[model samples]
Target: MTAHGRLPVVYFPEADERLSSWAARMAPFYAMTVSEFVAALGLKGHDVFDLEWRLSEGQGALIAARTGLSPEAVQAMTFRELGAAARMMIARKSRSACPHCPEDLHRKAAAQPWRFRCKVHGVEFRDATGETLSDRFGADCFKKLEGHAEAGAAHLDAWACGAGQGDLKAPEVLQVLTARHRRASPPNVDEQPRMSLKDRRDYQDFLTTPILRQALTVVVPEYDQAAPVLAKPVRPGLHALAQGSLLQCFALTVGIGRIIEDPVKWAISVMLVSDAEGQGRVRQAISPWPLSLKRRISARFWRAERDERARQSAEKAARQRQSHKYRLIQSHKYRYRIS
Candidate 1:
């Protein structure tokens, strides 16, 4: 189709490919850098940097002539023409590229913060260079987390969507639940303000063990089965493992409805006090904890809640001040307007 009578490489952009990524792929086939390829097409200046810009009909025709693709095909690859969902999921930074993606194809879905796995490969998505914790802990250890992968993904999606909608209560419950579980775990001897490499490796190993996995399993069982297991006498050095597992389960299972109902108070009361005292009747329950421990946990939750409320109040005040200033400025600007 070109005046030189040479056809460009017959390459079709992948569904997830960005305009720049597709150009990068085509550049290698033509023995040119991506910048050079853009230059060859007479797309000078900022046009080369405008990766998401829609191609005009003239621009599309010119690109088609040089690349041996239909003008429509080039337009299809442009991001500005993509549907709303696709646009929302587009990656602005190159770091969003999936390292494990075959042929180095950038994925649009990878742009979502909640998307941790490459669905096609069934592997956790690594950074742009394709590295993961498995490189250090070994593949076997990494596989432990994979067992809960489906639930974890769904939980993350729900949490992300809820957070995006300004619903903070669910996330707050998750934070409290995880903190309680983490407190039950044995203290790391190497714990410091900043963890050393050894401490990090040890922590990773700790999380991958069977004890934690068993605790997470408790979440899926019915209340009767779960209560008996939780009631078992705590063994020395195993408290942390049990707690960590329970925390992960709560994080992955607690829904917005439970959060709205303020179940944290009921759950904590039940876990720390026997049903006879906390519920006015004996029921399936964990052995009561020391009164002091119960008070400490309750106080921590209240303190966190108070701090969050203060933070929200401050933000609202700031917004109101800004709005008032904007109205004042607008009123002055309209002072001389004709009545």
Candidate 2:
């Protein structure tokens, strides 16, 4: 086999391996950049990262032919079957370090928000701080919150993967959680003021107020003692967060889980409290909740209103009957006195 041919060596794709990961791993072995490597494999017109989601049959066939991998194996590395929302959750690079994985070869689980463990190893991933969730959160926190964290992770996995078919939509739920609270105390930290202008990223936290962090405390009182932090304060959705920021992801999902379990209370306690500072910006998130949820909440209030009206009408009719009885009693007494 020539240097460029089906030649030298081939690496089979790892289980739950990312398309980019498989390609990147092979690229260095061949003394080619990832682009150069795939180009040599009779591939063109699509970026390697893009192929992580959109690898076509033709593209898969080209890769499978050269690498001795089945087309199914090639396709498994990509997330083409996942919906757009789920696809958006993919991290560009592995967010956490897995003890079991080879250096720099990220598994698909590493890039996915719904998973916090190394898929192959079944152990937790070490995040940027070089700490597992237990290391970062400490013994007490790890014990108490781990189950909640797992619950939240399962909620997101189900919602993102379309397995739950529940009323909660993760993005809309996050919108409510992160919505600015009208009555929240100034989030201005003293240290925040002293930071210099050149280090602009630090200022990003201040630009967006401390909403999710504070809101999560309500979701899980266990988090009340723990100070909340955000990688980037302004987030449009969970997918928009810095992928490796597992701390934020954990808190966000935990809050989402609690909200999913009880949306009305979440809306009243978390979303409604946000500043009506400007008309109904906060209310907007509450308003567009999937119709089933909105109806459930509305139905509860509607029943209360109907019950109150019925009670009032009953009281009024009783009062009229009592008045008539009193008048008849008075007339009978008057007639008896006359006789």
Candidate 3:
């Protein structure tokens, strides 16, 4: 339908260019909209945007034949080669953009959370407002997690590409990191009665956030000193973060590296500072860890539980003895009836 009976217009896909981007660019040459161009090719029930990640071989071949490009080249323009892991991490819309490239020429990697730089230009990506990862985390603070993010990014990229199926998956690591380590501390500011009505009411609302007087502070204990303030009982997990902002992805990337160093140690250390519920949460959260690692964690967890029970039992006995002595003293006083 496009330039009928004439030779196909020659248009090459940019390196790492998304299939959607190529079709869009070529659409105007034939005076057709992207959707019309795709429809004319007979790929019905297929969204133009999804072509980046979900194109079938038949569809790829059809596009190739119409565009005068090989099927392999057409497939390369999609996420077909990146594997499903990258598919899960790909944002529905671009999260960051390359400063040097035109908006229409963004690469496929730009939509992937693991990629911090432009695959085509080798430049760091920036948010819509021109904020880079370094800016979100100040240059000095970013320096702390940058190394971990780099190494973790590589590890994650390799794992997603099916390189390390035997190792722990990224989602498990993130959930384990989210296990609450420390109880929430009282807000730094105090709520005193007799304050203005507005102030007192605000304070009341803060404390009474439907609470059993427990302020649950869910956090990554290792990043306690640096991570941004997070909402209570809400920890960063892979699903909550797969399409997250650059900063969120960066944090998870650092966490992936930090825990991989000694996953068991991190789990135990987090358990130590947590309450009974928090500890139990960790015990359950680690169920997906590899078998050998799971055994080691379980052994340590049971030992710690036994020790805590023994200590509590000893304290209960001491309290009973003290209560008995106090009763005897009261009976003696009643017998004497002295002033």
- What would you estimate as the lDDT of candidate 3? 0.67
The best-first sequence of candidates by TM-score reads 2, 3, 1
Minimal lDDT window, size 10, model 1? 278-287
Error of 1 at 94 (Å): 5.3
lDDT (Cα, tens digit) per residue for candidate 2, span 1-42: 343357368888888888888888888887889998878777
TM-score of each: 0.39, 0.73, 0.72
- Candidate 3: worst-modelled 10 consecutive residues by lDDT: 211-220
Candidate models: Cα lDDT each: 0.46, 0.68, 0.67
lDDT (tens digit, per residue) of candidate 1 on 26-125: 7788787888777676564535436445677777787787777777777766655333432333344333334556555654445443344564565655
Clashing pairs in 1: 184-240, 185-240
Best by lDDT: 2
TM-score of 2: 0.73
List residue ranges in candidate 2 displaced over 4 A: 1-5, 162-164, 183-214, 221-224, 228-234, 239-244, 271-275, 295-339
Give, for candidate 2, the lowest lDDT window spanning 10 residues. Answer: 225-234
- Candidate 1 or 2, higher TM-score? 2
